[model samples]
Target chain A: MKLREQLTALLTSLAGVWIMSYAWIVLKLGSIHVPDAGFLPFLCGAALAVLGVAWLLALHWTKRKEAPAEKRLWHRPLSSLLLMIAYGWAMETLGYISSTLVFVIAWQQIVEKEKWAKTLSIAVLSTLAMYALFVHLLKVPIPSEFFLR
Target chain B: MDIFSGLLDGFAIALTATNLLFCLLGAIIGTAIGVLPGLGPAATIALLLPITYVIGTPVTAIIMMAGIFYGAMYGGSTTSILLNLPGEAASVVTCIDGYQMAKKGRAGAALGIAAIGSFVAGTLAVVGLTMFAPPLAEFALDFGPPEYFALTTLGLLLAVTLSGGSIIKGLIILLFGLILAMVGLDPISGKIRFTFGSIGLQGGFDFVTLAMGVFGLGEILYNLESTMKTEIVTTKLGKVFPTLGDWADSRWAICRGSVIGFFVGIIPGGGAVISSLASYAIEKKYSQHPEEFGQGAIQGVAGPESANNAASSSSFIPLLTLGIPGNAAIAMIFAALMIQGITPGPFLVAEHPDVFWGVIASMYVGNVMLLVLNLPLVGLWVQMLRVPYGILAPVIVLFTTIGVYSTQNQVFDIYAMLFFAAVGYLMRKLDFDPAPLPLAFVLGPLVERSLRQSLLLSGGDPAIFVSRPISGILMVIFVLLIVGQTIFFLRRKWKRRCCVPVPPETEKSL
Candidate 1:
C-alpha cells in the first residue's frame, strides 16, 4: 500500500511533466496579452506538478509507520478487464453475435463457474435479444464483419 | 407564459400515448437499475441513449430520460432498506436506518414511506421547476460570454470542492477531463489538438461512451474486485403500506427534505447524494429523538429518500435552463438533447417549449407512476437482486460494449470505453473522485469558448471577468469560496497541531 501510494505520486508528477512538455513542444503558447490553446494546459500541468510535490511532502511529513504489502499482479477485476478487452478485439473479427456469445458463455462458465447448460442458454438468448433490440427495433447496424457477411 | 398554461401545454404533449408509454417504460427500467447494485441512472441513460435516436421527437426522448433520473431515486431506497445494499451513492445514507427498519420487520413500512415521500418530493420539485425554470432562463438571457465563463468556472470549482476528497486530486481529475475535452478539432481554430493524428480521434470521445465506460463498465469492474457474496436479508415484508403513525412521524421531515433538496439541487455539483446527506444531517440535528436515528427512525428514511428524489428532479433546472448539467446524469441528458439537434440553454424554453415543458409535465406523471410502480412491483425489484453479480457484471460489460459500438457503429468507441473504464477503476483505487471529471468534460469546451470570447470582446483584458456585474459577482463568489476553503484547511491544521500531544522524540526533533 505504501509503495502504491508513492508510485501514484511519482506517476502523477511524471504525467504533469509530460503534459507540460507536450504543450511546450507541440502546441503554441500565445503571449499573456493573447492566450492561446496551450495556455490552460500549461497552467494546469504546472499546478498538477506542484500539487503532486505537495502531496509527496505531506506524506513524508506525516511519517506514519507502515509496511509495504505483497502486490498481487492479477485479481478478479483485472481478469474481467482483460476479458472485456478480448471481447472488444474479437467482436470485429468474429462479429457481434458470435463474439458476444463466446464472451458471455466464457464469463459465466469459467469466471463464474456456472452450469454449462445455463451459461450456453443465457449467452445465446442474451445475444439474440440484443440483436433484435439493436438491429431490428433500433435499426443500429452493429458490425457484421465476419460471420453475417 | 403563465405557469399553469405552460404546464397544461406540457401535459398535452406528455399525455400522448407514445410519450406516456415511454415514460412508464423509463420508470420501470429506472427502478430496475436503481434496485440493482453496480448500476446507476447515469450509466443506464448512457446505455439507453441509442434508443433515443429511434424516438420520434426530442420531447418524448427527454421525458423518458428525465423519468429515469427521478425514478431511480424513488427505487434506490428499496435495496437500501431491504438488502442493506445501497443501489446508488444517493441511497448509501438510507442503509443506516432503513436496513435497521427491515431488521425490525418494517421493511414494507420503510419502503412504503420512501415511495410516498419520494412521490411527494418529486411532484413538488416539478412544480418548483415549472415556476422557477422559466424565470431563471429569462434571467440567464442577460448573461454574456464573460458571465458564462464565470459561471462555468464557478461550476467546476464548486464540483471540485463539494466532491468530498482531496481538493488537489479533484482539480487534477478536472484538469485531466479538460485535457481530454481538448481532443479533436479546436472549436475555435478547427485545428486538431490531441488527436495524435488518428482519424478516430477527430470526432473526439463520444459522451455516451465515456459515461457508459466510467459509470457502467468501470463500476462493474470495481465491484468484481469484491468476490465476497452479499448476504441479503430475507425479512418477510410485513405491511406494504406505512401506518398512519409512520406518516405522522415523517410528514414534516418529508417536507423539510423536499425544500432542502430543491435548493441544493439548483447548485452546480449538488446532486441526489449531497442532498440526501445534507437532509439526513439536518434531520438528525433537529430531531427531538435523535437517538432514533441509525436505529430505524422513520424520519431518517423519509427525509433522505424524499431529499434525493427532489434533488434528482430539481437538478434538471440548471441543465434545462442554463445548459449546465449539475451532475453526470444530467450531463448525459444534455448530450442526448445535443445529439437530437436541440441545444439546451436560455432559449430552450422559447425554442423548444414542447421538449422543455413536456419533460416537466412528464415528471408529474412519472412520479405518480413511480409511486404506483415501486409499491406493488417492489417484490419484482427485490427478485432482481437475486441475480448474481457474476452474471450481471458480464452482462453490463456486454451491454456497454454494444451500446458504445452502436452509437456511431465505430469499433474505436468500444476501445475508448475500455480505456476509460480502466482509468475509472484506477481513479477509484487511487482515492480520486471521478464525479468532477465528467462534469468538467461536459463544461470544458463551453469554458474555453466563453473565456476566449470574453477575452476577445475585451481586447484581452482579463478584467472583463470583473467588469461585468453578473460575472463580477460570480467571480467574487468563486474567489471567496477558494479563500474560505484555504482558511478552513489552515485552521483545521492549526487545531490539530494544538490539540495533539507531541511525543518526546518528535518534540526533541522540533
Candidate 2:
C-alpha cells in the first residue's frame, strides 16, 4: 500500500514535469495580451506539480498506516483485463462475432469455471444479440475482419 | 416563451409514440441495472451510448437518457432495503434504516414510503427545474468569456470536494484530464499539438472512448477485484401501500428533503450521495423520535430516498443551463448531447428548446413511470439481482468493447479505452477519485477557449476576469473556497499531529 501511494505520487509529479516540458518546447507560449496554445497547459502543468508536491508532503507528515493488503485481489481484474485486450485484438483479426464468441466462452469456461453448455449458450446468444442490435438495428457498420463481411 | 406553453410543447414531443417507448425502455433498463449491484448510471449510459445513433432525433435520445438517470435513482433503494446492499452509492444511506425495517418485517412499508417520497420529490424537482432552468440560462447569456472561465474554474475546484479522499489526489487527476484534453488540434490555431504525427491523435481522443474506458470498463475491472458475496434476505411483503401513519411520519421529511436536495443538486459536484447524506442527518435532527433513526424509522427511509431522487433530477440544471455537468452521470449526458451535434450551454434553452424542454417533460413522465415500475414490478428488478456477476461482468465487457468500437469504427479507440480502464483501476486502488477526471476532460476545451478568449477580449490583461462583475464575484468565491480549504486542512493536520506521537529524530527531520 505504501509503495503504491509513493509510486502514484512520483508518477503524477513526473507527468506534471512532462506536461511542462511539452508546453515549453512544443507549443507556443504567447505574451499575456495574446495567450497562445501552450498557456492553459503550462498553467495546468505548474498547478499539477504544486499539488503533487503537496500530496507527497502531506503523506510524509501524516505517516498514515498502510491499509491491510488483500490476498490475490488483483488476480481476477488482471485476468479480465488481459482477456479484454485479447478480445480487442481478436476483433480486428477475427471479426466481432467470432472474437466475442471466443472471448465470452473462454471467460465463462476458464476464468469463471462455468459449465460448458452454459458457457457456449451464453457466448453464442450474447454475440448474436449484439450483432443484431449493433449491425442490423443500429446500422453501426462495425468492421468485419473475417467471417461476416 | 412562458413556462406553461413551453412545457406543453415539450410534452407534445415527449409523448410521441417513439419517444414514449424509448423512455419506457430506458426506465426499465435503468431500474434493472440500479437494482443490480456493480453497475452505475454513468457506466450504463457510456455502454449504451451507441443506441442513441439509432434513435434518430436528439430529443428522443435525451429523453431516454434522462429517464435512465432518474429511474436509476428510484430503483437504487430496492436492494438497500431488502438485502442491506446499496445498489448504488446514493442508496448507501438507505440501508441503515431500510434493512432494519426489513428485519422487523416492515419492508413493504419502508419500500412503499420510499416510492411515495421519491415520486413527490422527483415531481417537485422537475417543477423546480422547469421554473429555474430557463431563467438561469437567460442570465447565463449575459456571461462573457471571463465569466465562463471563472465558472469552469469554480466547477473544477468544487469537484475536489466530491472526493472522499485527499483533495490533492482529485486535483492531480483533474489536471491529468486537462492535459489529456490537449491531445489533438489547438482550437485557436489549426496547428496540431500532441498528436506525435499519429492520425488517430489528430482527431483527439473520442469522448465516447474516454467515457466508456474510464467509467464503463474501468468500473467493471475495479469491481472484479472484490469477491462480493451478498446474502439475500427474503422478507414477506404483504402490502405495497404505505399506512397512513407512515405517511404522517414522513410527509414533512419528504418536503424538507426535496428542498435540501434541489439546492445541493444545483451546485457543481453536489449529487445524490451528498444530498441524501445531508437529508438523513437533517431529518434525524428534526425528528421528534430521533432515537428511532437507524432502527427502521419511516422518516429515515423517506427523507434520503426523496433527497437522492430529487438531487438526481435537479443535477440536470447545471448541465442543461450552463453546459457544466455536476457529476460523472451528467458528464456522460453532456457527452451525449455533443455527439448529437448539440453543444449544451446558455443558449440550449433558446436554441434547442425541443431537446431541452422535451427532456424536462420526459422526466415528469419518467418519474410517473418509475413510480409505476417500482411499486408492483419491483419483484422484476429483484429478479435481475439474481444474475451472478460472473455472467454479468463478461457481458459488460463485451458491450463496452462493442460500444467503443461502434462509435467510430476505429480500433485505436479500443486501445484508448483499455488504457484509461487501466488508469482508472489504478486510481481506484490508490484512493484517487476518477469522477473529477471525466468532468475535467469534458470541460477542458471549454475552459481553454474561455480563458484564451477572455484574455483576447481584455487585450491580455489578466485583471479582466476581476473587472467583470459576474466573473469577479465568481473569482472571489473561488479564492475563498481555496483559502477555506487550506485552513481546514491545516487544522486537521494540527489535530492529527497533537494526537499521534512522533519520535524526536523524526520530528526534527520533519
Candidate 3:
C-alpha cells in the first residue's frame, strides 16, 4: 500500500478506538434529566464507531484486491508549510500590517519567485488595502504597534 | 397583480442608485473572481464576509454576495471557452465543447453561445423561483428533525449517483467526510469527540481553505509538472466575438438546463453543484452526437454553464423561503442575516418585506449587470491563464491560508483547512469527487441533531419519525433508493461478468 493508504488505515482504526472510548466516557456519566447531557454524546459515539468500522472495512476490501502502488502521491510543499507556520507566529507579534507584509513578501519571493517589482508592489498594496479595510473601514481592533515601532 | 404590486415596492428599493451600484459592483467582482482560477463563490464570499459585516442591512449585504455567485457563473465560462481550463469546478464540463469550438476558430461563437445560454437559463430559473418559492417555503415551514434527516438522506443518495465513479468508493468518501465532521465539538452536549487535545482541533475544518488549497494550489502543482512536459499552445489568437447562429442553436439547451437546474436547486443540500452536473449529463444523453460531448462540443459548454448560473440563482429559493442553506455560501448569508436580527424563514416575507423583496429585486438587476460586465471582460480573464504557473502558484496558496485564518482569527481553522486540503487532494488524485464529501460533512450534524431531537420528542420511541406522513413518505423513498441501488449494482456487475465470449473462438465460428 502507498503511504496515504497506510495512513488512512491507521487513522481509521484509531478513530474507531477513540469513538468507543467516548462512548465509555459518556456512559459513565449517569443519566440525570429526562434527556441527559450525556445522551447526545453517547449517540454520536455510536454513530462514529459505526462509521469508523465501515471505513476500516471499506479500505481493507478496496486495498486488499489491489495494493496502491508504493509511491509518493504528492510532493510535500515544505516551503509553503513553514511559511504558514512563520506567518501564524508572526501575525500577532509582528502585528497585522508588518506581519501581513512580511508574510506576503516572503511567499512571493521564496515560493512564487516573482520579479521584485511585482512582489514588492503586491506586498505594499495588499497590506495597505487590508490595513485600510480592517482598521480604517471596519474599525476592527488591530494592533498597530508592529508598524509604529 | 398579486405579487407584482409588492414587487413594485421592491423595484423602488432595488432601483435606488446605491442598491443598483452594489448589484453591479457585486456582479463585476464576482465575475472577476470567477474568471480567475483559484477563486470560487464560497471562498470569495467567505473571504469578503468581513467587508459585508461593515455594511448596512443584512439583505443588501446578501444581495451583493448573491450577485457575485451568479456573476461568477457567467464569467467562469470565459476561460472554459477560451482555454480548456475551467474557471470553476462546476464549469469543468464546459471545457469539452467550449474550448473545442474555440480551437476550431469559432471562439466568438462559443463565447456568444455560453453568454446567451446563461442569460436564458438564469431568466427561466428566476421565473420558476417566482412561481414556486413561496409555496415551497411554506411547505418547508412544517419540517422537523425527522423530515430534515430524510432530506439529508435523499441528498446523500443523489450525490452518489450524480458523482460518476465507483459508487462504493463515493459512499466511503462521504462517510469518511461525515466522520471527520463529527471530530469537533458535539453540538448538543458540547463534548469534543475527535479533538486530539490541541485547542486547534475544537472548531473543525473550514471548507473554503480546503477547497482553495486543494483545487487551487494542487491544480497549480499539477499544471506546473504537465506544462513542463507538453508542447504549449502556439495558435494565433482568432476573432473573439461569437456569432448569432451560436446563440440560436443553444437556446433550447439553455432553456432545458435552466428548467432542470431551478428544480434541482430547491433541494436542501449541494444543489448548485448537483444541478450543473445533472444538466450536463442530461444534455449529453439527449444530444444527437454524444461522442462529441467530452471533445469540445458548444452545447456541452452552453448547457452546463447555463445550468450552473440557473442553479446559483434558484438556490436563493431555499435560503429565502425555508430559512435553510443549500450550501456553505448560503450558510454564511444565514449567519449575516441572524447578526442583523433578520430571521430568514417563512414569516420573513410578511415581517421583513423590505429586506426580502429588496434582495429579490436586486437579483433581477444583478443578472443584467453581470452579463454586461462579463462578456467584455472575457479577454482579461483569458490573459490571466497566460501568467507563468510557477509564480502564480504560491500566491494563490498564501491567499487561501490568510483567508481561512481571517475567519475567526483562529490557528485551529488553518490546521483544519490543511488537514482537509490533504483529504481533498487525495480524493482528487483518486478520482473520488470532493463535492459529496462537503455535502456529507455539513449534513451529518443536521442528521444527528434531527434524529436525536426526534427520538427525544417521541419520548424515547423511534416510531414518532415514521408516524408523520411526510416523514414516512421520505423515509420510504430513502429505503427504496438504497434497495434499488443495491439491486442495480449487483445486476450490472453480474451482467458484466457473464457477457464475455472468447474473442478468438467467436471470430473463428463466424
TM-score of chain A of each: 0.86, 0.88, 0.71
Correct interface contacts retained, every candidate: 0.35, 0.67, 0.06
TM for candidate 1 is: 0.95
| Clashes within 3 Å, all models in order | 0, 1, 6
The TM-score that candidate 3 achieves is 0.83
Local distance difference test, candidate 2: 0.86
Candidates 1 and 2 compared by DockQ, better number: 2
Model 3 per-residue lDDT tens digits across residues B235-299: 53455445566666666778878877887776655456677788889888988889978776767
Stretch of 10 with least lDDT, candidate 3 chain A: A61-70
What ordering of candidates by lDDT runs from best to worst? 2, 1, 3
DockQ score for model 2, please?
0.57
Candidate rank order under DockQ: 2, 1, 3
Quote the positional error of residue B101 for candidate 2 in Å: 0.7
Taking the tens digit of each residue's C-alpha lDDT, what string does model 1 give over B14-51? 99999999999999988988888778899889788877
Cα lDDT of model 2 by residue, B27-81, tens digit: 9888887888778888888888877766799988888888888888888899899
Q: Give me the candidate number with maximum lDDT.
A: 2
How many steric clashes does model 3 contain? 6
